[model samples]
Target: MSKHTILGETAIQQLLLDLPDWKVIENKITAEFVFRTFADAIKFINNVATVAEEMNHHPEFCSSYNKVRFSYCTHDVGDKITDSDLKIAKQISELARNLNGKSGY
Candidate 1:
């Protein structure tokens, strides 16, 4: 397993081009998704968990009813957004797209 490191400003900018929905906080990348219901939110979390497991990179998350807040930061680098965070952010966006028409209720 490779440890995650913070990306340079230029690299971060390029990555953010693909993830305009995500916000950068103190160099950490974050995004919050809202669903139609609690069950839907849970399902979304499950999907994220699967992706995280497959990539061996997890996120800090909070959930309540229809909202799921996901914050991705490489703790190995003192909670800074790294290439890993950008990669996962893109993956999460893909997951949302895949579930576009099949949103849980």
Candidate 2:
């Protein structure tokens, strides 16, 4: 087993409450927001990807025109969720919010 296995739904729920802008989705947390244009959304994802890549984490993302949805969970640890997942989730939420002056999520 891995550290991610230690987290349960209740713990995840509390973390989600504290994180306001992110939502827990089973083992993944998702955040979504719409941008001024498709180009803007793509730029935003690229920026987010840079931070995620640096952290050795990545998001499962989808884009439709100006809308973007991102899901994050650590993949190395049996695709299980962990504090690392929540940390990155919060960090991504903060960075994206700061960039646009809104949570966008």
Candidate 3:
């Protein structure tokens, strides 16, 4: 399937099985990562930025203190989940794990 193709419910659910921290909400795959320190959270965000840039797939995110919530969707495909979104979610999850960012608020 094309990377930009919108994923169906079953496909999304199956993909998410490997991404335990991520959940499909309102058509987007989202996860909140909490770090021990605000600086750590910022570091994770910076790493995410670099990866997102390299992949040319940006995520919608918000950070507060030591927590960062990321939401991923393919806007070009009408804000629906796609392969690109799942790929980035995986990358982000890996980045968080490497940086000691705990999943969830």
TM-score leader: 3
Where in model 2 is the C-alpha error above 4 Å?
Answer: 1-6, 101-105
lDDT of each: 0.76, 0.75, 0.91
- Per-residue lDDT of candidate 2, residues 1-105 (tens digit): 654544678898898897877786766888887777787778788888888888777789988897788887777776666787888777767666655624455
Residue-level lDDT of model 3, residues 9-89, one tens digit each, is: 999999999999999888889999999999999999999999999998998999999999999989877888999998889
What is the alpha-carbon lDDT of model 1 when measured against the actual structure?
A: 0.76
How far is 49's C-alpha from truth in model 3 (Å)? 0.4
- CA displacement after TM-score superposition, residue 29 of candidate 2 (Å): 1.1
> Which pairs clash (backbone N, Cα, C closer than 3 Å) in model 3?
none
Q: How far is candidate 2 from the true structure (C-alpha RMSD, Å)?
A: 2.5
lDDT of 2: 0.75
Model 1 misplaced stretches (Cα beyond 4 Å) = 1-5, 101-105
Model 1's TM-score against the true structure: 0.82
Please tell me which model should have the higher lDDT, number 1 or number 3. 3
